[model samples]
Target: MDVLTDLLQRSRARGAAFSHSTAHGAWGVRFPVGAQLAIHGILGGEAFAWTDDAGTSRHVLAGDIVLVRGSAEHFMAHSPGAETVSFLGHPSVGPPGGAQRMVFGEGPGSSTTFFCGAYTFVGDLCAGLLAGLPELTVVRPRSGSSLRATLDVFAGELLDDAPGQQALLDSLLDVVLVQALREQLAADVHAAPAWFRAMDDPTVGSALRAVHAEPARNWTVADLAAEASVSRAVLARRFTALLGVAPLAYVTDWRMALAREQLREGATSLAAIARSLGYASEFSFAAAFKRHHRMPPGRWRTASRRQAAGLASV
Candidate 1:
């Protein structure tokens, strides 16, 4: 799959959120690594996010999407002078008043509102995609952009106690993430990373879309070249230059990613999944999975399921 699709899948698997009001007297809040990807959307009032990068602090306002990508230790408070607090029961802290932290929940008050969630990425494609980002990514929606409108809608939905609101909130979180990535790609015009640069190229973007759309297809370099409407040699060179991998290799990686997701869900048996992914047999799929994840399909699935269960308990 393309990097964006891979990221979206990983995000969905490992993401959660909590929403509540910041206590009026609450001071600084510190988030530590492995704490999860936390995103705060201001509903009313304002606060600043402070980090120790070079002993400096960055300030954000309402309507901005503040992403602590690495779970780096950072604090949020009503003012810079507020006393910092440690996260209770963990390394980070929330505002006072014992506000109930809801993973992807709605707030009950008019305090400065925030949505906190975390995502854990898997596979080399996702790792490479995230490596290019800053430790903390704060995306401020441009004026009149669709991103702003989408965030506004998210805020409104969070405020609204509608039926099935949790599912709606989850979908809105995905939109917010996609829009943030789009904004990041649009604003970056320099010699960007391979994934971002690939998306910007018409040929590479078409090729990526085709691969993501039909990852199980028996794809050859020539097939991707034809899809991009370019000669085979040209397609190969451009694809490698922009994506840091050959066309067929990229397709293989994407197929493996899909298989990983399928295995985690226990959606089908190994043989069925292998067949659906165009593998010759369960044996071949197991060998490939072992090569990629250093374990056979069955073992990987068990481990992944266990890990997922542990996360759920948290």
Candidate 2:
């Protein structure tokens, strides 16, 4: 798979708390800090979001989406200094087959209607995608951006309590998430992972996909260049410039990441894991894993499990 698709598939979150909320005069909502990511899209009126109680914040007009990356504690309001409330007692409704809604502020006044959602991720996931993102990302679409059109449909779906509404809303959220990520990935290509940044390069992107799709392949830079129909010198120069890593080095890192995941999740033998990642033997794989993770695979697995459990309970 390509880098964007790979990140999305691996980091696709679960048990998301999706809600459509309305705020009229004098309103604010505080989303406390946690690992779950918070996303907000303004459909009507406006809202401002900030990471701190007093810092420069992003103003969101209609057709704008904001991602509170890394789940930093944040506040959203029609105005910056509005009286805020916790979501604990917020009027929320999720009819059996309907989208969830939360309403606040006074009625019959200018209201900012928005959709907000949070998704839970396990195992300290999204290392490549989320690490490349900032503390907050606001997707302000220029013309021809898919995010704006999708927001319109997503907002309409939130209004009705129709059959299969929950499933529909979930699917729509996925679309919005992917679109936003794609936009960000495009804009932040230079700073993102090689798989993401290299996607625009016809030669480098094909090489990236080959490595991800078949981690077992004994891939050299020359092999990848052949796959991309480019010469070795051209591929090497372009790959290093665009992706910030040589092709073979990236392949080794990717292999180790896959091996680590298999070690953490599978009861399969070490030899199997090593063979799957194209290692000649378990001894070689263990030595590489030690270098990548600063610990042997067995110890890393134990420690990683403990850390994951700690994060889950927090």
Candidate 3:
């Protein structure tokens, strides 16, 4: 798998609830801040979207897609400064495959049609992937692009209550997310993190794919260099130059990322985690992890779980 795909999968990214809403005249809705990512697609009409903490607001027209990241309460409305009520429950109009529209401001005026989706992700690796994006990303669709096509289908699906509409909508939302992300990352190469942009380089990109594909493998600079059919010195220089870390250091970092996730999961034993990450023994893995994180693996796991539990209780 490519780096992006691997990151998405490993992070366990999944769609939460979704809704199709329409508003006439002056209307606004405030979305709570929780989802790791939120997708707003303007099916028809126009609206303004902005985060509460961030002053960035964009006037989005039909066929426009907005991607919001981070835990910031955000709003969408006919105007940027319009008053908003909490978009509580995002209740649908009917049952599954039923009319999924939520209406606001019944008075006669210009109508705005849009769909909103929330996505939740697990693990810090997901943060690495998202770190490349700005707080708000807006993309205007091309007339015949795949994202446009997917959005069209998504809008149509909401209108039709098919046998498996929920499953279908969920899947279609995933497609739209991937397409929008690809478009944004491609259009703004400099804004993307160096490791992601590095995926474009023939030399470094090849090595990165190899490392992501089998991070458990004992990778030497020569092993990675061989993946790109380049000299060790050449590969090391290019990899370090692009990613700000040597190839093997990148490997260790990735492994540690995996380790933290597994540790947080609290199911895998230390020996198994060590073996899966290519450590010769649990002791060796613990030693390496301590060096990287400045805490023993067991202590780190306990602390992480405690922190998570504390947050969950709140």
lDDT of each: 0.68, 0.79, 0.87
What ranges in model 2 sit over 4 Å off? 15-17, 188-191, 312-314
Candidate 1 lowest-lDDT run of ten: 97-106
Worst 10 residues of 2 by lDDT: 8-17
Give me the candidate number with maximum TM-score. 3
- Per-residue alpha-carbon lDDT of model 3 for 120-218, expressed as tens digits? 888788886677777787888666889998988988888876688878888888898888988888888888878778999999999999989998999
| Candidate 3 ranges beyond 4 A from true positions | 89-91, 97-99
Using Cα atoms with residue i matched to residue i, what is each candidate's TM-score against the true structure?
Answer: 0.75, 0.90, 0.95
| lDDT of candidate 1 at residue 110, scale 0 to 100 | 30
| Model 2: per-residue Cα lDDT at residue 235 | 91
Candidate 1 per-residue C-alpha lDDT over 1-314 given as tens digits, one digit per residue, 9 for 90 to 100: 56576566754535544454443434456656674456666655667776667254556677787776663676676666457655544323333322234321123433465666556655333555566566666778888878788878877766566566666767777787778767776676353466667776888888888877776788888888888899889999999987778988877776787788778777689999999888898999899888887889898889988988897899
User: RMSD to the native, candidate 3?
Assistant: 1.7
Q: Regarding TM-score, does 1 or 2 come out ahead?
A: 2
